[model samples]
Target: MSFIALHPLRTFSDTWRHRYLLAQLIKRDVLLRYRGAVFGVLWIFLSPLFMLAVFAFVFGNIFQSRWPEQTGGMPFWLLLYCGLIAFNIFAETVSRAPTSVRGYPSFVKKIIFPVHILPVVPVGVALVHGTFNFLVLLAALSWSGNFHAHALLFPLLLLPLLLLALGISWFVAAWGVYIKDMTQIVPMLVQMLMFVSPVFYPASAVPAALRPFYDYNPLGTVIESTRSAVTGQSIDWRAWGVALGFCMAACMLGYAFFQHSRDEFADAL
Candidate 1:
């Protein structure tokens, strides 16, 4: 009898071993998204800018929203945008994970492929979008005079969320191969997460009784710390360290789950 190896180390090695293929896939994934559009790839740059304007107008002007403990009097939209950028990366990646494996039957049945890397493709694509959003955020921050030197740490701070997103992506992508309904269910959950997360509001605004739950939410912690990085507020390194630990463990577990389940994908599909 043959045995399948579930070693967590293979996750990194598999990804590294196929780095060129991954890059080509990611590039194709990105270009294919806007291939037929009139504006083409320009939409990538334009779409986020348009959304930022809408957010600024709706949140900053219409709603009259304000951060609970805002010290710099940063525009509410700017604060909201900071958190949204981080959340969007996770949300976008996970929402697409289910379809990632399900959409590519050829890869599973007709050819030899590293299906484990399929999940990472969504994270890479989302990061591409997130990168554009971050550039826009920096422009907004600079325009509003809220840019902080600490914001340089923004990418570093995103480590945990990136790991978390990749982990969830792997788990969902594998499950999506077996359970067709996951494609629908995962997006709905991502929508609910947006509300539960501190994206549009501050953690400080949560009621005291509920604060503990909010504090423990890894997404909330990342959002808060990310906001601090943007606005020059003090970051909770202790909390971030804890989140990083959790994310790393989750990433490994997710990779293990994906590898263990992949053997059945060809038959299931």
Candidate 2:
């Protein structure tokens, strides 16, 4: 008898090996999200603009908030939007991961599909949303006269966060199949995480003792660095390096776990 070996490296290569299929899945996922809306795909562009308007009204006009040490005269809402873009990418991807696998029984029981790739669909969809949000941020910065060449680095700065989200998605998607309640629980945790991360607030706003925790958080570090990229401030390369290392490890481990647990998926469902 002959058997195939599934290594951690194979997890990544398989995605690449089936890149076309993955793209189709991602495209289908994005279309399905806004399928019934009157605006259709236009929501992808309008949704972020609406959120930015809300943030401007609440934080800019209502609260009149400001960063502890504002950079380059950037408005409070623009600053908040930068961090929110990064956090939203992570939040949206992870919150939907549980449903990615559980919601599609045909992919698992009735077809010869790469079940692992299903978790990636959410991350891809979130990236599409985040890209639109980033463009809106650039337009706001340009209108406010805060746009900079460094803003181009925003996409590169978010690479680590993307990896981390992909990792978490794989883990949660696997568990969600066996434990149905995970779908309900993950969104709450993600909402809590948004507050804990440096989205609405800056790390400087945190107490001195708790500063170290923010310093070590991958999401926080990514948010801070992404903001820096947008505001043309000096990025903390050392911190980004640490986050990159952690996210790489997480990606590998999550893929391994998913592959291991997937064997029981058919039986679980």
* Candidate number with greatest lDDT: 2
The residue-by-residue lDDT of candidate 1 on 1-269, one tens digit each, is: 11233344655787889989888999999999999999998888899899999988998789977787766568888888888899999999999999888899899885578888889999999999999999999888888887899998998999999989999998999999888899889999999999988998888888899999888888889999999888888999999999998888788888888878888888888
- The residue-by-residue lDDT of candidate 2 on 135-218, one tens digit each, is 999998988899999999999999889989999999999999999899999999999999989998889899999999999999
What is the RMSD of candidate 1?
A: 2.1
Where does candidate 2 stray beyond 4 Å? 1-9
Give one clash count per candidate, in the order shown. 0, 0
Clashes of 2: 0
User: lDDT score, residue 252, model 2?
Assistant: 74
lDDT values, one for every candidate: 0.88, 0.89
